[model samples]
Target: MRAIVVSEPGGPEVLEWREVPEPRPTRGEVLIEVTAAGVNRADLMQRQGLYPPPPGVSEIPGLECSGVVAEVGEDVEGFAPGDEVCALLAGGGYAERVAVPWEQVLPAPSGVTLAEAAGLPEVVCTVWSNVFMAGRLRRGETLLVHGGASGIGTCAIQMAKAFGSRVVVTAGTPEKIAYCLELGADEAINHREEDFAEKVTADVILDIMGAKYLGRNVSALNTGGRLVVIGLQGGLRGELDLGALMARRGSIISTGLRNRPVADKGVIVRGVLENVWPLVAAGAVLPIVHEVVPMADAARAHRILESGDHIGKVLLAR
Candidate 1:
């Protein structure tokens, strides 16, 4: 088996494809022959030595993947060998084979290909967990998402709209803003040119920039708003005005999926399969892939994701 190995922590050049021992399924796990892996910002962070995989997890960097099941471990009953599936993984999606717990695995949606399905898990699980489950974005209320053209942002826009929520997004480019609008975002703001804090008030805010947008996010919140911060692309430290948040009756939540326990991830995965899967199958939402690079050429995929120019998911296809 071959997987993308980090020679050392640095740039995209650090990612190398090399032969490695094949993984086998363990108790309650499933072994998958990887078809494609979704490239995410977290993978880049891992390559730069910022975020390492959880204990006892693979070193390879990938958060989601789609493939055929090669084998099933003891107690894995919902899946069988040869079943087509996609999984939300903590790590190791960059390899040709990965063993993961069955609870995080989901049957490929009826209308999407295995390659496309690879892009679904991470974005869907993240959006459903943060924007809906944590932020409590309800129908008729506006949901603001930073990085509106990103893989998670694209998925968030469509999923929120499908669930009857009004979606508002902030993107750096006009092209990205237009793309978000086409995906059903009711409002699109160019963060480069406009201050979103003055323009819109939202019931829920899904923010990626941590310290950079903290003040503005609180300012943009509507009464009793939930502000969910899922990524820290911006600087870590930020001055929080608890007075403003209290005045607006707003709350801030910080969450991440990678370090969560298996049972917690399973709960989010089940929610996605039950709720978001139907939207994908019905064409109300889709995995918006920007490009699919070869598995062996994962370095190129990392470059694409780190560029911040590509809209939607970038996949490394085997």
Candidate 2:
């Protein structure tokens, strides 16, 4: 088997595709022959030696993938050899083969291809869990998404629209903003030119720029707003104003997908399969793929993502 390994962790140049021993299924796990994997910002962080894989996990740097199950470990149920599935992973999706807990796997949605399905797990689970489950966004409310052209942002826009909520988004370029509007964002703000805090207020804000946007994000909130921070592309430290937050009765939360326990991930995965899968199958929401590069060209994929030149998900195909 071959996987993308971080050769000393510095830049996209550090990612190398090399031969490695194939992984086998463990208890309640399934061995998958990966067909495709989604490239994420976290993978870039891993390459830069910022976000290491969880202790005892694979060294490869992918968070989600689509594949065919080659074997099922003892005690795993409802999945067998030859099952076509997509899964959420803590690591190792960059490889041609990986072993993932059965709880994180789901059959490919009825309408999406196997390769495209690879892009769904991470974005879908992240959006569904954060926007709906934690942020508590509901119909008739306004939801704000930062990096609206991103894989998670694109999915968040569509999911909010499907739930009958008004969606607002921030993007760096006009073309990217247009793309988010096409996907269902009611309003698009150019983060480069506009102060989102003054343009509009939201009942919920899904932010990626953590520290840099914290103050403005709090200011942009409507009364009773829920602010969920899922990424820290800007920096780690921020000043919080308790006085302003208290006046609005707002709540701020920060979360990460990796490093979570398997059972916790399972709960989120099950919520996605039951509540979000139908929307995907019906085309109310869909995987937004920017490009699909071969597995061997993963370094190039990482460059595209790190440059922030592409919109939506960049998939690495096996």
Candidate 3:
């Protein structure tokens, strides 16, 4: 098999496609023939030596992929050879084959092509877990998402709207703001020109710019609001107004999916299959893809993600 290897951690140019040993399924795991892999900011972080895979996981940079089942390990059930599936991986998605725990693998939804399904697992799981399960975004409430045109943001907009929540977002450009509105966001604030804290209050805020937005995010929250920080695009350190947060009875949570135990990921995967996949199948929510690059040119895919010009997911296909 062939896989993308980050040799010595540097720019995207360091990614090399080379022959590698094929992986085999272990107990309770399934082996998949890779189709397409989703490119995420985390992948770039890993390439730059800022993030490393969890112990006993693969070194390849991808976090999610859509593929066909080639074999099932002992104790695996409900999935057979040749099943179309997508999975949330801890690592190793940039290869032609991946071995994943059965719990994190899901049957591809009915409406979208298998290639596009590659973009769903990471975003769907992130949104479902942080925005709904952890953040407790309820129907009729307003949810604010940072990076409105991103893969996670795009999915959040559609999913929140489908569940009867009003969605608001912040973007850096006029084009991005318009695109967010097209995806059902009720309000799109230009972060470059306007202060989001003055524009609206929200019941829940899915924030990615960790430190830069910390103080303002608290100020923008409605009473009893929830702030879930899932990314650190803006740096890691910040001071919070504890008095204000206490007055509003607000809560803050910081989380990530890549380091959780498989049992926990299983719960999130099942939640998505039960609650979110239906919306995808019914056309109420859909995956947004910006472009698909070949796996051999994985460097190009990384470059696209770093450009920040893409409206949605950038994929690497076999």
- TM-scores for candidates 1 onward, in order: 0.99, 0.99, 0.99
TM-score, candidate 1, is 0.99
List where candidate 3 sits over 4 angstroms from the true fold. none
Q: Could you report the Cα RMSD, in angstroms, for every candidate shown?
A: 0.7, 0.7, 0.6
Better of 2 and 3 by lDDT: 3
TM-score, candidate 3, is: 0.99
Question: In candidate 1, what are the lDDT values of residues 192-243, reduced to their tens digit?
Answer: 9999999999999999999999999999999999999998888899999999
List where candidate 1 sits over 4 angstroms from the true fold: none
Report the C-alpha lDDT of model 3 over 1-318, residue by residue, as the tens digit: 999999988999999999999999999999999999999999999999999999999998899999999999999978999999999999999999999999999999989999999999999999999999999999999999999999999999999999999999999999999999988999999999999999999999999999999999999999999999999988899999999999899999999999999999999999999999999999998999999999999999989889899998999999
Pairs that collide, model 1: none
User: Residue by residue across 93-154, what tens digits does model 2's lDDT show?
Assistant: 99999999999999989889999999999999999889998999999999999999999999
C-alpha lDDT of all candidate models, in order: 0.94, 0.93, 0.96
Lowest summed-lDDT stretch of 10 residues in model 2? 7-16
User: How badly does each model clash, as a count of residue pairs?
Assistant: 0, 0, 0
